[model samples]
Target chain A: MTLELKDVSLRFGADTHIYPTSLTLDPGSFNILLGTTLAGKTTLMKLMAGLEKPTRGEVWFSGRNVTGVSVRSRNVSMVYQQFINYPNLTVYENIASPLRVARIAEAEIRKKVESLAELLKLSPMLERRPGELSGGQQQRTALARALAKDSDLVLLDEPLANLDFKLREELRDELPRLFADRDCIVVYATTEPTEALLFGGNTACLHEGRIAQFGPTGEIYRAPKDLVSAQVFSDPPINTVTVTKRGGEFRLADMAAWAAIGEFANIADGDYTLGVRPHHVSPLARGENPVGIDGKVLVAELSGSESIIHFTMHGATWVSQSHGIHPFEVGSQAKLYADMSRAMLFDKNGTRVAA
Target chain B: MNNKTINHAAWIFVLPVVALVAFNAIIPLMTVVNYSVQETFGDNTFFWAGVIWFEEVLHSSRFHDALLRQLAFTFTILAIEVPLGVAIALAMPRKGAWVSVCLVTMALPLLIPWNVVGAMWNIFALPDIGLLGRGLNALGFDYNFTRQPGDAWFTLILMDVWHWTSLVVLLAYAGLVSIPDAYYQAAKIDGAGSFAIFRFIQLPKLKRVLTIAVLLRFMDSFMIYTEPFVLTGGGPGNSTTLLSIDLVKIALGQFDLGPAAAMSLIYFLIILLLSWVFYTLMMRSEAQ
Candidate 1:
């Protein structure tokens, strides 16, 4: 079903849990709610699932106002972050519970449960209780239970967040295909930007109980509407430096200047914060148009394939994620380069100045 | 992980509890064992009774009748209290100021002394002037607990239920509250009705607490003496003379110490065996 929230807001006493926000989620599309922890993603999902009523505004499902409807009356299923399965039930029984509640035929329940269990690779463990399964297996059982209902809307609230790294990667890869042909509005919430990108769906980036931006995932990542959205979409955080514009030249802390290029001409900048992603900021190189800045290496952390370099530039800390091992000694001065074409600028109010 | 040093000093802390158990449980149990094997006449006179008293008590029709009555009472109350307590717990409000009020009221019955509960019910169920008895008689029913065997049984069972069902309610409430909200939410999302939720979610979650409630009620009700003894005084026709009352009549009233001791040992063993069977069955089901 197509779900729409019109000016929905939630408040716990005087504290606002979710600000007034409106969103329209089309059916048969994979929708991603991308945000950091405590960003109101779960609250918004609860509102859509009818688990929590909005303090104001209305929820429309399939063109009908359903704000007053109970969760049991709504055809929606949710898989929580923590693997929530009926502990006393076998995996097969867990998957079949919803069908049994619906009073579906026994033969249909058996067929559906077996097929879903096979699909989730839980065929062998179907007779085992949730307490006996591994975390991934338990989550799969929960997923199977949610899927067996064949509801119009399926919500996954950071469903892979509790699993180990390897299992998360495996399941994250399988999610898109799992719901590929399903005629349901699948909403997946996650804190990881890469997962949203990997899922390849329309995303709503939320920050501080508000939807910062909502559009195609790729488009939002490429062109964030505001500074918060840009920051929320970045992994190791976007590197920002305050710069002032005079005529066609942009001056950074009276230390460096570069001529305005392309869409920068449209921005009437007095003082603007320039944001460049960690991947875009690299070790200094002498080829082409590169905006260079001097920084002192603070710390260098090397993972398996890449190293994150923490450096101080213009009295502010910045991070640069370099492609391979590029170890920089602490307290040593280094120069970083940013390609101007990939840089983003925001005004004092944190609205993105497109370039 | 196994390389940690063992602390011998921890035994010092455990010594007090061991001594306490020995004093409170083991010593009294040994005394019962001593009495069961030996016969005592009066003024420190004693003789070897061997297994004769056990055989006599086992063959006695009076003991058999009291045992049957005790079993009937225990099972009857178990049947009534467990479901009634769970239903009451389900109806109780899960939150807000009323929670404390409900809990306190439920606990009030449990806190009253067993004899006081008996006394209170005895007056309350008096045929001529008592509120319940007068109300029932006014409602046109022949209700005289003091004179009728059926009414005596009814009053006894009612008194025990009123005295002990609160324990079950408290335990079931605890089990119900411990269930996470996620289970209910998931049930709702799956379109489960209230009965389905209770059958699949609440009942399964309450299994452990219900087991404890059943076992406790079984043991307590099997050994029940004070409440019914005070309420009906074994009744006008011995209708409410449960095993404990009969055992007390043999042991202290008529001073038949040998058969009474043997019967007490048998009673202890019966409770032990039944509790073990109950625990084993419940655990086996849980494991499966």
Candidate 2:
């Protein structure tokens, strides 16, 4: 069934957890809610799940208004960030809980529970309680339970946030595959932009209780509608610098000017914010129209495959993430090349100007 | 030669606590043991008596009656209070100003002195002048706690339940509040009804505190003395006489110190054995 949230908003007194928002999610592909923590991704999910009633607006499911329906009455399932399971129940029972609630036959429950357990690699721990299991195992049990429900709508609220790094990676690769055959609308909320990109689904970038941008995950990453969307879609954060376009050249804040090329050349001649991904601004000159700028390096970090450098340029601190090791000394001046062709130009109101 | 260095100074730090324990608990217990085995006549004259007091107390019909009465009272109160307290806690407001208000109201009865609670109920249940008594009589039911054993048992159990159920409520409420909201929300999404939620989620989460509650109430009610003594004073013809009251009657009323000490030892053993059994049973599921 197609789930549509129409102008739903949640307010607690004067505080708005989620502004008036609308989203239509369909089955087949994951609809990712991509944002930093407290960006109202969870609140919007709660609204969709009927856990919390919206202050205003209606939720439509398959062309029916279900705004006032209780979560128990709806065919829905949710897995929380905290590995929430029936602590007193064994892994087998935990997976069988939703089926039991639905009054399914015992044989059917056993069949579904065992299959889901095998799918989650929890067959060995079927008799173990949640308390006896590891964090990842518990979460797997919770996921198995959510899957066993086989509901039309499944909400995963940062389901891997509480797990260790290795388990998160393990689950991340399996999540999409697990939900592939299910005829349900799956909504996954996450704070990490890289996770959203990894999922490669439709994404809604939330910022301060509002949807900054909503489109295909790759599209939003390649061409963010605004500076905020770009920032929300970047890990080390999209570096931004205000530059003036005049006389067929771009002049940065007290920095050298470079000839405007491609999409940058086509924009109107006015003061605009230029946002570029950290990887685009590298220590090596590689892209078209590369402009070099010198700045004092603040910190240099290397993570086996790449070196990330934080430097201050024209009173604004910017990061340069490049492949391979190029360690720069702290407090020393270093010149970095930024690919102007890969930059996104935004107007004074932060809206993308260039195509 | 041993290479390990031993630190003897740690013993100095533990000395004071050991001394305190010896003075308060160990010495008194030894004295009780000493008294349990010997018979004392007038002031300084004493004679060794082998398990005679124990045999007498154990086989006596009087002790049996009081033991049965005590067991019945304790189990009755536990049965009434635990579920009632849990129900009340579940019904209480989870948040807002009403939370503190409800907590304070629940705590009011607990804060009252044991004797004061017994006295209050004693007066309250007086057949003629008390509100409960007059109201019951007005309702035309033949009721008199001072005369009937059944009525006395009712009054005593009611008084105990009123005075102590809040302890269970407070403990259960603490357990209930510590559970994260995610469980409830997940249960809702899983299509669990109210009883299922309680049975699967609330009861399991409350197990730890409920264990403690049942333990405390079990021990306290099993060895109950002050409240029932003040309220009924063992009542007319010893019908309401519990173990503690009977022991007191033996030890002080008849000056039968030897028998009382023996009975006290048996009482202590019973509580310890039962508590261990209860704890094991309650925690047996967890070991899995």
Candidate 3:
């Protein structure tokens, strides 16, 4: 089903949980709600599922105003972050509960439950109770239950957040294919930018109960509309420096000037915030025509194939992520360079300045 | 992890409780065991009985009748109270200022002394002037609890239910409130009706509390004495004479201490066995 929110907002007593926001979810598409904690992702999903009534505005599902409809009347299924299954029921019974509620025939319930268990890799543990299974298996039972309902919309609220890193990685790779051919709108909420990127769907970036940007996931990651979107969408955090823009030249902290790229010619000369991702900022002499800066290394952390270097320059601490091992001792001086063509600029109001 | 040296002196702290139990429970129980195995008469003179009292009480028709009545009463109350309590708990408001109000009201019945509860029901169900009795008679029913055996049983069961169902309600309410909201939300999204929600979520969650409620009520009702003794005095032709009342009559009223002590031991054993069975069954299902 196509789900649309027309200027929906939610207020809990004196605190506003969600500002007025409108979004339309295409049917049978995977949609990702990406944000940090307390960014109103769960609230938005709850409103869409009819679990909470919006304080104002309407919720439309396929042209019907369902803002006041009860959750039981809506054809939707939700899996919570905490593994939630009927504790007294076996895994097979948990997956079959919804079908039983609908009074489906016994044969159909068995078939559907078995298929979902196979898909989620829970078939071997179907007879075991929820408490007896591992956390990942329990969450997979919850997922299978949600899938067996065959509802029009499936809402997952950070369903894999509680699992360990190895299990999370495994499930993250399998989720897209699990829901690939289902004729339902799948909405997944996550705080991990990498998970959102891997899901490869439409993403709505939220910040402090407001939608900062919403578009195709890859496009939004590549070109965020504002500084907040960039900060929310980046994992290691984008590197930013206050710079003054003069005609054809950009001065950093009034210390050094660099010729502006041809794409930035139309920007009027004024103060602007320059943002460069850590991957684009690296050790000097590594890239052609790179902008160089001097800094004292504060900390260096090497993990797997990359090293994250924390350094202080121009009275501000900045991070540089470089490939391979680059052992820069603390308090040691090092030269860093940033690829000018990959840098982003924002105005004083935090809006991105288009190239 | 903090590694600390173990102190053997911790046993000293528990000595007071051990002494209290020895005085209160062990001494009294030993006295009853002594009485059961020997015959006692005036001046504290004792003679060896060698389980004769146990044989007499076990073979007596009076003991059989009292045991049957006790079982009937216990099972009846369990049947009525468990479901009724859960229903009332489900109907209670989950939040707001009214929750405390409901709780306080439910606790009122439990706070009254057992004798006072029996006396109050006795006066309230008097057929001549009591409201319930007069009202039922006026509505064209012969409802005289003091004169008829069936009416006496009816009034006795009703009094016990009114006095004790609140305990079950409180326990079930506690169980209901501890369930997280996510379960309800998931049930709703799964298109479950109210009955389905209760069957799948609320009932399963309440299993532990209900087990506790059932076991406590069973033990309490089995040893019920004061209330019925105060209300009917096991009268109306001994219709409401439960085992505890019968035991008291044997030990105190007629001073037949031998049979009474034997019956008391048997009573304790029965309660222990039944409660063990109940707890084991409940915990076993929960483990699964």
Candidate 4:
């Protein structure tokens, strides 16, 4: 089944329509509506879930118009970031709520709830009230409840955002596992760029109510289509700085950069910002080489197993994720080289500049 | 929180409630206890009545009539209002400007002064010239609250319902709004009918708010006098005389201070005891 949003626009009051946008999702593939807060990511999901109506367009589900349909008529379920559990219910009753409403046989409801409980390792807490459970347990119950619906589409609005670090890490894999067996479309939304990369689905970046880029996680991370796309995504934020082009070569602190970047070689010279991920930059020997740049180490943070080194080149500052414990003193000169093949470029307006 | 700070601040927070109870409630209760054992005539004259007044008040035919009438009136108001309010709250829109519009309109009845509420209903439900009475007469019905016991009873009940159902509606609506979209979303995916949604999700979630609504409405209806008094004047006979009306008649009309005070104490205890019972029952259910 395929879901399509065609020229959909949601206007708040009389003016300020979020955006006139269109997109499509294929069933059996995970879709991530990754965006910043207040970017209307949830709004788009709500539109598809039949919880709301778009001001101006049709929502086609399986080649049929489902716009303006009540949430009950449309088979859709969603889990929110707050881990929305029926506070008045025990975990067993919480998960069984949906099935009971469907009038499933009591025996089958018992079997399904128990089985799901075992899968999520919540057997011991099934009889416990949601109010008495821990955050992780509550979240697990919420996930189990959402998965129990067996809807054609499942929407999750950062269900893991409210979790603490260790719990977040533990359940990171369980999210994909929730949809592993279902022949359904799952749309997960999050503001964290690393989460999108971690989710590793068909990542769709929804920025400012529009898709900035929608593609495979690896491709989007390796080579973002545009500048805001690059910065709006990527953790430690892909380092960005302005560079001048001369003799058809881009120069930033004397680094010999490539002139062509995939499909961007035909662009003209202009004031532009160069983007590079911290992991792509490497420490090099201090030498008068034409292919490398030298800088002073501004700061270094050693976070347990790994260290993040800050290097200043000319007037711009950039970070490099160093291996092991590489301690550097302030004001000490440090030489670093950029991996030009992995570098990204953007114009003055923060739009990706074609190579 | 840390234990030391919590322990230190706990009594500080509880002190005001304790003091207010002592001054406004507990001490007055002691005076009532003292008065229940004595009798007084003019000029501070006192006699060891020793439960004579309590016996007389309890055995009084007027008190018995008022008590039975009070129970019927309160239950009638509750049975009519609770379901009616829940239906109105259910029919209310989930979200939008319309939600606010409906909420504000519901709150308007609450904003009217209690006596004015009585006056408004008095004029609205009058027999010959009143809108309802005139309208009913026009519709080919003999509706005179002043002369007919049935009319008086119906008018009193109807007027109480109009003035107070909004409280239930507001409380139930608040409970309904607080329910997260997740529960409904879950219900929707399960293909729940409206009735199932209410039974499984809405009713359970509304229990706490419903408790408060129930107790407040019961107390208000139980103590109700103004509107019924204004509309029927507790007249055509004792058909509309609730406990509060009887208490007022004995205390204010007949100048029987001792018996009235004794009845007032009983009335206050009934309200307090019923409120406590409701609160405890609701809390126990929540605990379970």
Candidate 5:
């Protein structure tokens, strides 16, 4: 089924939770709501699920307007982040509850419950209650129950957020494949940029109760419509600096200048904000037309395969993430390279002007 | 190497509580034990007796009658009050200004003194002039609590239910409110009907609170005293004479100390045993 949200907006008294936005999600591709905490992801999901009604719009599903319909009337399933399950029921019964509510035959219920339990690797603990299972196992039970419903719309609100790191990795790898063959509209919400990129479907970047951008996941990441979209799609946070364009060159406040090249040369920039991803700004020069930037090292974090250096440049803190461990001491001078060819320039109002 | 120091100094901190318990519970209980085992008359005199008092209290049909009556009253009130309280709690508004109003109204009956409740019900149910008594009489029903043992029992049970059902309502409401909203939302998305929601979600979540409510009401109703004493006075015969009232009649009215002491111990033991059984059963069910 195709789920469509048309001009939907939600407001609580004087505060707005979701602005007027339209989105249409198809069955074959996974849809993602990407945002930071309290960025209206959950509220938007609730509107789509009919858990909450929009103050101003209608929800359409498969050519029918389902606005104001109760969630129980709609074939929808949701798995919460808190690993919510019926605490008093065994895992098998918990998975069977929806089928029972649907009044499926006992034999069919047992078959579906057994197959779901086996798929979730919970067959060994089918008789155990939710209280007796580990966090991951309990969440798996919840997921199993949701899957057993076989609804046309399934909403997952950060299902792996509460699991431990290794458990999250395991479930994350299995999630996409689990929903692959099902002809359903899957809406997954997350605050992690890496997770959104890893899913690689249709992404709707939500920022401060507004859809900053929505398109194919890779396309949105590679070419954000605005600075807010870029900011919402970055993990280490995209670095930005405002500069003036005059006489075929961009001039910074510190008197450093660079000849505008490629897309930069074609834009008429009075005062524009330049955004560079952390990886694009490295301690060593690599990309074409690299520009040297000097700053005072503030913090240096080294993982096994990455070096993230935080430095102060032009009175603003900037981060440089690259491979190999580069130990830069605090309060020491450091020079980083920014690839001008890869930088994104935005207008004064935070609209992307040039790549 | 096991190296743990015994802290005798901790006893000093607990000394006050120990002394308080000793003076209030231990001393009074020892006095009862003394009375249970000995025959006492005037002038602070005592005669050493064995288990004669226990045997007498155990064998007396008067004691058996009162015990039966007490069990009947306790179970009847439980059967009526628990479900009624849960229904009232469920009907209450889950949020907004009405919640506090409902809570305060539910608490009003519990705040009244036991004897005052009894006296209020007595005046309210008087066959000659009280509102409820006259209203029932005018409605073509023959109801006089003072003259009929069945009417007395009915009034007594009605009064007790009114006085105590609020306790269960408050506890059940507390349990109902403490459940996270996500469960209900999930249940809605799962296509659960209202009854199924209650049976699987609300009822199981209420188990702990209901257990506490049942245990408290059971203990309270089983040992009820002043209300029945003031309302019925164990009167219209011995029909309304519960265990505690009968024990009081024996000890204070007829001055039979030995038998009263033995009966008191037995009553205390019954309450303890029943409460333990209830707690263990409820906790075991939770464990599964």
Candidate 6:
């Protein structure tokens, strides 16, 4: 559980340039690195796992400098995105291989493989080879095999990303509990925010090469520290509408709040965009507030219990979410105003202007 | 697709192959079985011999000698070739342009026709004009395969190794290339030594291909007649007269088809039974 990266960097091509300039993984907790595709998430995992060494920096495991240590010396297990199951071996044999190669006692190998198979619900198909199993079954068998290695550090490079939604959720929920007995540190990398929140022990938001933010999941999601972090937090990509102050009036497309928008009080308002989560936006009832926008409902898309309504603003779109089966037709005349207390203000350069 | 319709189409596809193989192999096989149990001195004439040739072969000094030679050659080739092929295959680059180059280079010896292989080695191993023989002689070794029985056997085994090691190399190399990087990573985590990596990962994974390589090498080595016959011509004495060479000496050279036919049947049966045993053992291991 004492894995550490002292200035670890990984370079993909011969450019001798690193993808992530510098990054560190927290030990003994599920640290999820959330980033977009090609953000070098898997590269970070590979560097940590010792499959490929970092071109520039040293990797330390258990306080020992493992810079020159080969992958066999690293004592890390990785579950790749693709199921790297041994095709020649049965589910039972695949799990038993690390033990068999280690020359463990025959009875112990059998007992361990059997119990792990049972835990993975693969007991019925233990005798079948990986080629015969379904994708989910094969993935679990692979997972079981990695678990059986009993390595202290587990680096999963989006293990559940390929599965269907139901299966992904099932495995995602079962992951923390599955490794509870071992206490092996897990570094789970995924781009999906829901998965990031699910693994919400310690989250590192990666942008380009550098970690934009590294802190507890709740703190990062709640504050976001910047516009990019806020954008990464919510779905339908956290809507932003430009808010400007002309003299004493706060104007935002045919809407003016008397006196002020409280969160917008301290910010210089020549240029500003209000960032609002879709779930937090609400339709303003007539006479409820003077600070309301007159706009046409551009598109209303209903998804189960909630509906997302896009309000056309000047040169921008403000998306408002109506909870509990509220359906609005497109092009309907609607009054839109987000609760000023719930919105965040961002200036140009896409950085949040602190209030 | 009804079962009957599906099955009828399958029989139509399989019938030609089955009939052709039966005509080529089964009819000849039945004839050999017929000859093994009886005596045939001339065309269409037979008499009950009641395992007489089998008795003669089992007791014959010549059969004993030929078998000893064949057994030595086959086992010797297997012992040297499997590990040597594996070593060369291991040294090959895992991927990229170099892999294709190395692969094609390894395939060169295999592509050379068998008789030409013998001819090349025969001239190469000759003491006067050949580079290898002259080099060895200059280095203080009196090398002569033409006159000495031991020298003939040594040259024949060496020739066989050169001619056929590529097959083993190709098979072992294919198996080696197929192993994914995950196993190596897992082995790394296990702190396995080089020998342990080879024993536990490389060897076990290469089992199926090695089985093919071993069975092929064994069968080819046992039935070897061309290269050694062309190179040694049975030998300066009797050192390199394998069962195939001896059988030909009887059947084609001496026109003793009676004993030769009996000998050929015995040789074929021995190969079939040995191949069956190897196939069974390999399949059983895989099943477990």
Q: Which parts of model 1 are misplaced by more than 4 Å?
A: A11-16, A53-55, A62-74, A86-89, A100-110, A237-266, A274-301, A308-320, A323-343, B1-17
Q: Chain A TM-score of model 1 versus the true structure?
A: 0.97
lDDT of each: 0.90, 0.92, 0.92, 0.81, 0.93, 0.79
lDDT pick, better of 4 and 5? 5
Q: Say which prediction, candidate 4 or candidate 5, comes out ahead on DockQ.
A: 5
Give lDDT for model 4.
Answer: 0.81
- Model 6's interface RMSD: 3.4
Candidate 2's residue-wise lDDT over B105-205, tens digit each?
A: 99999999989988999899999999999899999978899999888998999999999999999999999999999999998888788888899899999
**Most TM-score-accurate candidate:** 2
DockQ of 1: 0.51
Error of 1 at A345 (Å): 3.1
Writing each residue's lDDT as its tens digit, candidate 6 over A1-355 gives 4777767776656653335345455456777878777666777777777767888878777678887677766667778777776666678888987787667998999899999988888999999988678778888988898888887888787889878889888888888888776667788888888788877777777766656777788888888877877876666678877777665556665655544546555566587777878666666432223346666888888788777788776666778776666667788877765666666777787777766
Q: Per-residue CA lDDT of candidate 1, range A1-355, in tens?
A: 6899999999989999999999999989999999999999999999999999999999999999999799888889999988888878889899998888789999999999999988888999988999899999999999999999888999999999999999888888877777887989999999999999998879999998999999999999999998999999999889888989889888888667888877887778599998988887778553345788889999988998888888999988889887778878989998887776678899989998865
**Model 2: clashing residue pairs?**
none
True contacts preserved, each candidate? 0.68, 0.97, 0.76, 0.55, 0.82, 0.37
Q: Candidate 5, clashing residue pairs? A: none
Question: Each candidate's TM vs. the true structure?
Answer: 0.87, 0.95, 0.87, 0.84, 0.93, 0.73
Positional deviation of A98 in candidate 1, in angstroms? 3.9
Worst 10 residues of 2 chain B by lDDT: B38-47
Q: How close is candidate 5 to the true structure, as a TM-score?
A: 0.93
Q: Could you give me the TM-score of model 1 versus the true structure?
A: 0.87
* Alpha-carbon runs more than 4 Å astray in model 6: A1-7, A12-17, A24-27, A35-39, A49-51, A58-66, A69-153, A159-171, A178-185, A206-212, A219-355, B1-15, B27-55
Candidate 3 backbone collisions, by pair:
none
lDDT of 1 by residue, B50-102 (tens): 99989998999988888889889999999999999999999999999999999
Compose the digit string of candidate 3's lDDT tens values, residues A255-280: 56788866777889999999988888
What is the Å distance of residue A87 in model 1 from its true position?
A: 4.5
Rank by lDDT, highest first.
Answer: 5, 2, 3, 1, 4, 6
Per-residue lDDT of B126 in model 1: 89
Winning model by DockQ: 2
DockQ of each: 0.51, 0.77, 0.59, 0.35, 0.70, 0.22
Question: Mind giving the per-residue lDDT tens digits that candidate 2 earns over A1-355?
Answer: 8899899999999999999998888877698998999899888999999999999999999899999899889999899999899988899999998898889999999998999999999999999889989999999999999999888999999999999999999999999999999889999999999899899989999999999998899999998999899999999998988889997999997676899877776777989898878999889997987899889999999999899999999888999999999989999999999998888899989999978
